[model samples]
Target: MKKAIKILFVEDEEALGMVVSDSLRSRGFEIDYHTDGESALQATLTNKYDILVLDVMLPKMDGFSLAREYRKVNRNTPIIFLTARSQTEDVVEGFELGGNDYLKKPFSMEELIVRVKSLIGRLLYSEESQLEECFVGNYKFNIQKQTLELNGKIKTLTYREAQVLLMLFEKRNQVLERKLVLDQLWGDDSFFNARSMDVFITRLRKYLRDDSNIQIVNIRGIGYKLLI
Candidate 1:
């Protein structure tokens, strides 16, 4: 028998929660539904779920804080936010707080289901055996350890820096669109996010300056190319 997918779903609205949880359970998902963020946080620490579905608003604690705390310990499991706040900043904040997908309120069960399956599919696919480390212009980069080493010196990277660097390294010698990076990391391509990415790019350049052969070229008005 195929193993059932497990989900930790947190929603405060009783009626909506019932409908959604029941719908998911009917589709072969094992659901652990909660009405408050505090209990959800506890559940996260003790139980491992394939994915987490969190509502933006909840009693005792808000979803963003819950996700933030949850990320401190476990960064592998995917999280989706169910929110009524559709503002771009709100969406961006959720992603920054470690959310994988954001579904605004009034969403159809079909759309939610699709997103859940899509995230799980990607997660499973990524778990396949692959090279954990690679050489980037004489520097050894470890994707899982989030470390870059050169000549016996190691510089650990922040999560965002590692994520950006990984994306660039994956598409080395190719043009990586700025919008795609922003969308993947910041969940949007707004002015603020663009400036933020610029800062990161500058920092990355500083980190790789020792490797004279490596250059992250800015393709004016377009995107960036990692010319190694």
Candidate 2:
């Protein structure tokens, strides 16, 4: 049987929260709703959810601050920021802080539903063990374990990080289009998601820097080329 999607929804607005929760529940989602950031944080620390729907304005803590704290422990589950503010800076900050998507307030129920489904479909749960292992210069990358072994050390990677590395390895020596990476990994190719992809690429480059011959070359206007 297919499992119902679980959601952690935090909103301070009582009426709106009820409506949203009910709508999601009606659509077969398992919704755990909270009115304060503190309670929501506790809920997340104790329970697991497929996705997070967080309102920016809350009583105890705001969405951005809560997301920052939450990311310190959990980086896999996707988060969508819900805010009334439409400022580009605020949206950028949300993405920079690890939010997977952002939704402006007064959005349609259909739009919210579509965004949530998109994020759930984009979950980086697994892209591992497809080729057992790959050699990258002096490092041994174990796709299944999501680890990179260098000398005598093994460094673990987050699911998203591992997925990004796996994609690069699969497309080695070729330009992996930015749109493809952003769409496959983030569910969209928005400017915010593009920035996030750049961050991931930088991180991967740092991880593989021990090998001088390894390079993730930028294709100027296109994407990245992983050369070894």
Candidate 3:
């Protein structure tokens, strides 16, 4: 039998916690749910978890502070922030502070499950076996090095940027769902991360601007298509 993935879920709402915990357990995951950031942080230090589902607003300690403390000692674990805030700055702040994803309020359990799976899939396995090099238009992408070479100029990309570029390259000429991308990279499709992703996409566009054949086209409500 496959080993159950362990998750440390931190949320203050009792009803929401019970529902999400039940749903995740039914999906073959082992969840250790906490009601506040303090307990959640304590759990992190003692128990090993594959991923962390954290609520931004928590009693005793906020999710952002908890994540920072957790990252100081264990940096590899993926963190997904759950919050009702949709502000772009807040989303950007989450990412800047080491959050891998963000989910806004009133989200469906199905969407939450999908985001969890996507984050685990990429962080734990898929990313490790990616191709060493990929071609995007006239650009030569070094996945391992996180650099792109075009017209003899090498441009280094941030970790997040590289992940976004790789996703676009894999789905070149195909529309990649915006929510999926956000979840896979940032943990949630909050308005803030959406805006942050747009910034990253723009940076990618600038890097690949020399090659007119390559374009990251936004698909309005759906997502983005990488034209190559």
List, residue by residue over 135-194, the lDDT tens digit for candidate 1.
Answer: 999999987776899999998765567778888988899999999988766556877567
**What is the C-alpha local distance difference test score of candidate 3?**
0.84
lDDT of 2 by residue, 102-165 (tens): 8888998899888888877756445322476888778999876668999988887755677788
Alpha carbon lDDT of each predicted model: 0.84, 0.85, 0.84
Q: How well does candidate 1 score on lDDT at residue 161? A: 70
Which is better, 1 or 2, measured by TM-score?
Answer: 2
- Candidate 2 stretches with Cα past 4 Å from truth are 71-73, 84-98, 124-134, 142-149, 152-159
- How do the residues 1-228 of candidate 3 rate in per-residue lDDT, one tens digit apiece? 988989999999999999999999998999999999999999887899989999999999999999888877765567889989877878767765667777888889888888778878877674577588988888999986778998789987655777888899888899999999876677667766678998888888988999988889999999999999
TM for every model, in the order presented, reads 0.78, 0.79, 0.66
Pairs of residues at least 3 apart in sequence or in different chains that clash in candidate 1: none
